[model samples]
Target: MKRNSRLSLALHALSHMAFNTDQPHTSADIAAHAGTNPVVVRRVLGKLREAGLLTSERGHSGGWRLARAPRDITLADVYLALEESLVASPSETEQDMCSVEHALAIRVSTIMNDVEASLIERLSRTTIADVRHAAQ
Candidate 1:
């Protein structure tokens, strides 16, 4: 499966917030840093807020801040908050019953499952703290 840019952007935002814990960041600021639209940043941050990873405020002093410490937030946390399917595979929509295609489908499913497991496992090991430090 292809890497989702949305997921990467969410991670970047979270890492930025973690690294700058003393101050809140606006969507516009994050958008500029990530080189994306503010609306996209806001929507992604909204989901992160819902996942208890970040918090947002309104009004003149309104912005976003990390809900917890950088070490407390994992890449898996962001991925889960975004509700993304880590791995997507082709569905056997076409008829393959009683044919070699059936075996191919099973093999594909098994391979995809393995890949998904590895990906999630690796992602879980890296926290926002890790990204923040690495970016420095």
Candidate 2:
């Protein structure tokens, strides 16, 4: 399934932080590395911050750092923090007239939910540190 770049970006930034735990990374720095806008980076990282995965500081020398150790953060954590589902489920608003379409949509939605649950379970098995180690 095709997923949004936000998850990729989040994982990338976290992997960098995993290597350099002592230093903070700015949104601009991460954006440059990911080849995206700083604003987009901020928006993505902002969600991480709210989820307690990362912490942000203000001022010239200030930036973002991991709130928890890389080993303590799972891929599932990042995925859930971003709050975007990889599975394309049926829309909530359905056409009431078509019973066949409605039944199909319900079944598909149930299957998608199951797929998402499986995805989360699999992701929870791998931590950000695991990803960093794999990259090395």
Candidate 3:
């Protein structure tokens, strides 16, 4: 299934902030590291900030910083902050469907819901700190 890239994008931006506690990172700087645009970085991290996971500053020498410690932020937190799902079922189509097709959609939706729940459970188990450690 096609997944939204925002989750990974947010995680990447957060990792940069986590590693550089001594200094806040500019959107331009993170954009460079993430290989994306500054606006994209801003938009993604903007969600993180709204979720209380990070903070943003304005003016010269201003940038982005974590609101709390890396250990305090989970993958689930970042994922949810982006408001995207890991397992996405197909969108409902307007075309008329047979009874069997309707039944199958129901079953698939149930399974997809379960899969998403499990994925979220697993994501809750790991924090950004864990990811940082693993990356080292």
Candidate 4:
């Protein structure tokens, strides 16, 4: 299954922020670290801030910081904040099916739902704190 790259980038940014709790990181700095566009970093950070997972300030000394402790933020929180959906829509041809294909589609949808639930559950199980700690 293809996962959203934004989710991974968000997690990376969060982990970096969590590990450097004392320092607020600028979007450009985060973008450089994550090797992505600064606008992308800002966009992701904007969503995180709206979700109350992060805090930001303006001015010369302004940047982004974690709003709560790392342990308090789950992967699910970030994922939900980004409004990411793990399931991809089936193609028109896939949706239009024969009797056997219809049955398969039902089974496939059910299995995909279960798989998505499991994946999300696993993501939720780990906190940013966990990632920081594991790196030690």
lDDT of candidates 1 onward, in order: 0.86, 0.92, 0.86, 0.87
Candidates 3 and 4, the one with greater TM-score: 3
Off by over 4 Å in 4: 1-4, 93-95
lDDT of 1 by residue, 23-86 (tens): 8899999999989899999998899999999999987888999998999998988888898776
The list of candidate 1 runs beyond 4 A from truth reads 1-4, 94-98
Every candidate's CA RMSD: 2.3, 1.7, 2.3, 2.5
In order of appearance, the predictions have TM-scores of 0.87, 0.93, 0.91, 0.86
What lDDT tens digits, residue by residue, belong to model 2 across residues 1-136? 3233899999989999999999899989998888889999999999999999999999999999999999999999999999998888876577553888888888888999999999999999999999999989
Which one is best on lDDT?
2
| Cα-lDDT of candidate 3 | 0.86
Q: List, in order, the clash count of every candidate structure.
A: 0, 0, 0, 0
Using lDDT as the yardstick, the better of models 1 and 2 is 2
- Model 4 lDDT per residue over 1-136, tens place: 3233888889989999988899889999999888989899999889999999999998899999999999999998888899978776444475568889877777887888888788788889999999999887
Q: Could you tell me the lDDT of residue 112 within candidate 3?
A: 97
Residues 1-103, candidate 3: write the lDDT tens digits.
Answer: 2223788778888877788787889999988887888999899899989999999889899999999999999998988888878687968773666788888
Lowest lDDT 10-mer window, candidate 4? 87-96
